[model samples]
Structures are given as C-alpha cells and as structure tokens.
Target: MSALRFAEDWNEADLSAVHAVLVRSYWCEGIPRETLARAMRGSLNFLLHDAESGELAAYARVVSDRATFAYLCDVFVIESRRGEGLGRRLMERVVAHPDLQGLRRFSLVTRDAHGLYAKFGFTPLAAPDRGMEIVRPGLYLQSTSERAGT
Candidate 1:
C-alpha cells in the first residue's frame, strides 16, 4: 500500500470517492451528495486518500466552531483496505490537525469500533451526564420516510 495523503479540505470532485468508501464501510449510512458537498466546503472536514491511486480510502468530518467543542462525525474506512492501519493514520491527522489542537473536547459515537478509537485517547464518555448519540431519530425517520415514498 502507498503512504496515505491527508487532505484538510475537499473539492467538489472528491465527494464521490469519499462517498464511495462511506457507503461501503461498516458504518454504512446514507448521506445526500449535496449535503456532503456543502460540508466539504467548510474547513473542518478531513479526508484521507490513497496516495498511489489518488482515491479516497477513509473520511471523517469535525463539526466545530474551531474552538471549545468538536464532534467527529461519519468516520469510515473501506472494507477491502482494512487491517492496513489506514484508519489509525486517518484519525491521527484529524486529531492532530493544527486547527484542532486545543479544543475543550472532541467526541464521537461508535457502535463496535471502540478498540480502534480507544488507541487514540478516545474513551467512552462514562459519566452519567456524558454520553453520545449513536443515531439521530429525526434524521433516520426522515430518510426512512423518503425511501418508503420512493
């Protein structure tokens, strides 16, 4: 495998590659292409591409005001490329990016990848008052309704 290249910002053309991995990864969830395009326009998105093929292999986006708080969302790595440490490399860049260096807190919710994330100083929010959502009901409902209508 070639060394991974980190892209701190994405262009319109990069969305399809990024979305391809997202749709196939374990976290499989549907995100509208237009919504992803809008998110990519922001500065907080981090995309990792295979340097050799110039194809996106992993992706994660941080929703934040660049200070105080950031939520890591939509993290994924393609199945064919797992076990090669790409996920770790992706997380390293996202958490260490200069703009994200001193946030009050960074959080994400994962269903079964706790071991992978725990290696990066992320722990379960154990406090009674400090937990995260694995899914958004309204959004899920909206998607389901839309699909059913189709």
Candidate 2:
C-alpha cells in the first residue's frame, strides 16, 4: 500500500467521495449532496488519500467555534481501507489539530466505534442526561419525497 497523505485541502471530487461514504453511513444516511456541500463549506475538513492512486480513503470534519467547542462528524474510512490503522491515524490528526486544542468540550455521537474513539481519549459523556437533541431521522429522504410529491 502507498503511504497515506493527510491534509485539509479538498476539491469537488474529494467531496463527492466523502459524500458517497456519508450517504451509506447510518450517521448521515440520505444526507443531500447540497446540504453536505454547505456543511463542508462551514467546517474544518480533513481528508486522507491513497497517495499513489489519489483516491480519497478517509475523511472527517469538525464544526467548531475554534475557542470553546467542536463537534466531530462524518468520520469514515472506506470499506476496503479498514483494518489498516487509518481510522486511528485520522483521529490522531483530528484531536491534535492546533485550532481544536484546549476546547471546553469536543463531542461526537457514534452508534458504534466506541473502541476507536476511546483510544483517542473520547469517553462516554459524563453527563449524558444533560445533553439533549432534536433528531429527525430520514429527514433528507422525507424532504426528497416531498419535493417529488410522492
């Protein structure tokens, strides 16, 4: 395997690959491409590449205030790329990002991958009861169907 190259720079193709992964993931299933585009514009995006093939292998982004809080989201390593420690490498770069340091809190919601996050010092929330959210599962699909009047 070629060495992995990690960076914040991204282009349209990169975003498309990231979107492909996101659309299949439970966390972001049915996320609209335009919506993902807007989110990418407003967040700090990290991408990992195959270096040799120039394929986007992994991705993650942080939506943050750069001073007090950050939400890590859309983290993925393509199915063919797992078991290679790329996920750990990706998280290492994310948590160590200069702008993400000393934050009052950094958070993410993951249905699985607890072991992976744990390796990066991410633990179960100490105050889960204090956290609340308005979840709209399948909202994107719903919106699409509505748009088509189906």
For each candidate, what TM-score against the reference? Answer: 0.79, 0.94
- Per residue, candidate 2 scores C-alpha lDDT tens digits across 52-71 of 88898899999999999999
- Which prediction has the highest TM-score against the true structure? 2
Q: Which stretches in model 2 have alpha-carbon errors above 4 Å? A: 144-150
- Tens digit of per-residue lDDT, candidate 1, span 24-77: 444545656765677667637777788888888787888888878888877877
Candidate 2 lDDT for residue 120: 89
| Superposition error at 40 for model 2 (Å) | 0.6
What is the Å distance of residue 29 in model 2 from its true position? 1.2
Lowest lDDT block of 10, candidate 2: 140-149
What is candidate 1's CA lDDT for residue 126? 64
What C-alpha lDDT do the candidate models reach, one value each?
0.75, 0.90
